[model samples]
Target chain A: MIHEYLIQLLTIISIYAIAVTSLNLTMGFTGLINLGHMVFFGIGAYASALLTLNGVPWYFAMLIAGILASVLGIAIAAITARLKGDYLAMVTLGLVFIAIAVSRNWISLTRGALGLPGVPDIIRNNFYYMVLCMSIAGICIFIFYKLINSQTGRVFQAIRDDETAAAVLGKNTYFYKIISMAVSTFFAAIAGSLLVHHINFIDPTIFDLEFLVVIVTILVAGGLASIKGSVISVFALLALSEAMRFVLVSPALIGPVREMMFEVILILILLFKPKGIFGKVDV
Target chain B: MLSLNNICKSFGGVKAVDRCSFKTEENEITSLIGPNGAGKTTIFNIISGLTNPDSGTIRLLNKDITGMPAYKIAQSGISRTFQLTKVFRNVTVKDNLLIAKNTSEAEMKKMLESVYLHKPLDAIASELSYGQQRLLEIARALLKPHALLMLDEPTAGVNPRVRQELKLILKNLKKQGKTILLIEHDMDFVMDISDKVIVMNEGKVLREGKPKDIVKDKKVLEAYLGK
Candidate 1:
């Protein structure tokens, strides 16, 4: 039983590592405060689930889901290209509510809050599924590492540091910002597809504020603009949350207690180390 | 190579730049000098496309560039530095230059040395002193290909030694055939290096003449020191 639980926990961590790392590309590296990141994940999950249910192959469904999320990401970036700091944050936060409403109200397509359960598994065996998740996560991390070190990545950092200055240096800030959003959402959607396949279920709850908060917590603790920090923080936080399960002894209290723990850690990190562990750039 | 014809800009009810007109000679440094709020920086913003003119046209190489996006203007051969040093503080010195233009490592090092910034490429910008950061910003600006270089108060906060070095660097850039436009409060630096001086008062060109003649102009002296 313990072995099965460990495998499940590791799989979930790997999936979230992909999500957080992608979010870091926009939020940490590009200096976009994207509060509605989970909306892209939810979109990917629903797209994959519906496609697979309608007889599409699992891998193709996942790819299509990522593409769809990327399109939405580009649209959002173009619309909010002129906004910055708090205004941008508030606008992106609104996206979460909009996505949740759509998923809940679009009964004909999404089946409303009833959700699409029984999502097909990519691999029947739990151990093999975990391996698949880990492999995809590794690939995503490697890609992100290469991207953040490239010339284009330097432009992202420049825009983050000072948009006006970047523009004066002949960089098209709008184009780079949109590209960052597109790449970030693509990976986030892929993670969402992996998540739905692993658990064989997905719903409007995927767009929950709780989930967004959890992702933000991981990115903050990991440090902005740091992919390695995101990966490490995902593992550390998920392991700590799972370890708390043994101490709490009450399934009812686990959810709120876990959230509280995250809140405390976020507060402590902000208060003590505002840049986060391994954060090379300021938010 | 750059000319502004009757340029005007206003904020709310205030006319920040009103009927401002000037032209920069090719391969020479032209200084824009005036008292505080004389609309000097506003002219820079309008010319650089950071602000659209309420009226008039900006021409670079006789091409109408009025109201173009800042990046497009920059791509059209204008590189600029802000009055306040705007270095990418969190990144290394090398990354800052790379963002401007992806040049070779040796070229970037050479550019840095030209501006007397002797720091390691990997050193974070925020770790550098104020003067070093200014030098880094200048180096980043120079690293990009451009026909015109606009600098706003390049020696505002630097030590005297660095200020002297900046003078040498500006003179060297002039010798290299780069057209330079500058907004400066340091009269000595302006008078020493400027091939011509354009003085403004109340958002209009008060006087324009050679540095030697600008000092003797009655209107220019009144603009700087009230009657």
Candidate 2:
């Protein structure tokens, strides 16, 4: 039983690490504050669930889910291209509400609030599944590292720093922002697919504020724009949260208390460091 | 090689640039001088495509570039600096030139050296003094080959020593056959460097002539010396 719990814990950490890393591309590197990252993840989960139920291969379902999520990302980026700062944040925040409402009301597709269950496992053994997830996250981090080191990445940073100057230097920043959004959403969907496959369940509630807070807190506490910081923070925070499960607290208070703990940690970090452990620059 | 023909721009109901027309000849330093709010910088903004002229045309090599987006204009061999320099503060000095997407490492080194900003290549731009940051902006602008370079008050807030260095840099750029359109308020600096001068008032050209002619024009003195 302990072994199974360890495998499950590692699996969850792997999935959240991938999601947060993808979010880092936008929120951390590109300097966008994306409150709607969970919408893309949820979209990927539902898409994967629906496709696999219709007899699509698991990898193919994942691909389709990623594509669909990227399309949603592009849509959001195009619609909100002219907005910045608080306006951009509010628009993205609205996307989460919209996504949740769609999943709840579209009973024919998502089964409404009941959600889909018994999602097929990509690999049968828990240990192998965990390894596979870890490998995928590793590959993604490598790719992100390569990308940000390239000329393309420099332009993203330039735009993040001073958009007017970037444009004046011939960056075509609007196009790059859309590309960042699409790429970020594509990886975020992969994380969602991994989540459904590992747990064998799906529901609208999976797109919860808890997930959003967890992802953001991990990024902030880890350090903004630091890939290594993001990876390590994910593992550390997941471990911390899991450790709380054994604290002998009342079962009812566990969830709220854990959430409160994250909020407190995030606040303290913001007040003190504001840059996560590995952050070399500001968000 | 660049011309603005009857360019006009307004904010709400205030006319920032009103039917302003001027041309920057090849390899010449054309200094645009005007009192504040006389719309000199607004003209540069229009030419650089930061703010589209509400009406009228901008031409580069007589090709109508009116209302093109700033980046697209930049791609066509025009570059500009802001009145307040806009260096990417956190990134390394080398990364600033890299962001321009038009310079190799050796070229960037050469460009930085030319600007006398031969600090550590990996130094963060914000670590530089304010004058160095301004020179860094100029270095980043000239990283790529361009037919026209527009500087919006390049010496604003700069120390006199750095301002002297800037004059030399601009003179060197001119010797290499680069056309420059400058907006400056310093009469001595403007007279010393500019091949030609264009005076503006209330978004219209007050006079255009050789620098020697402009300094002696009664209307130019009246506009500058006031009333």
Q: Summarize candidate 2's per-residue lDDT along A1-283 as a digit string, tens digits.
A: 3498998998888889889989989888887789899989988888898888889999999999999999989999988887877798999999898988999999998899999988888999999999999998888888889988888788877877888999989889899899889999999999999999887889999878888988899999998778999989999998998888899468887888889889888888898888778886665
- Highest lDDT scorer: 1
Off by over 4 Å in 1: none
Model 1 vs. true fold: TM: 0.98
Q: What lDDT is obtained when candidate 2 is compared to the true structure?
A: 0.88
Q: Best by TM-score, which number? A: 1
lDDT tens digits by residue: candidate 2, B1-227: 98888888899999888888888888899999988899988888888888988899888977778889988888888989999999988789999988875466788888889998868889989899999999999999998556789999988899999998988898798788788999988899899889989999888999998989998899988887876
Question: List-wise, what DockQ does each model earn?
Answer: 0.88, 0.78
Docking class of 1: high
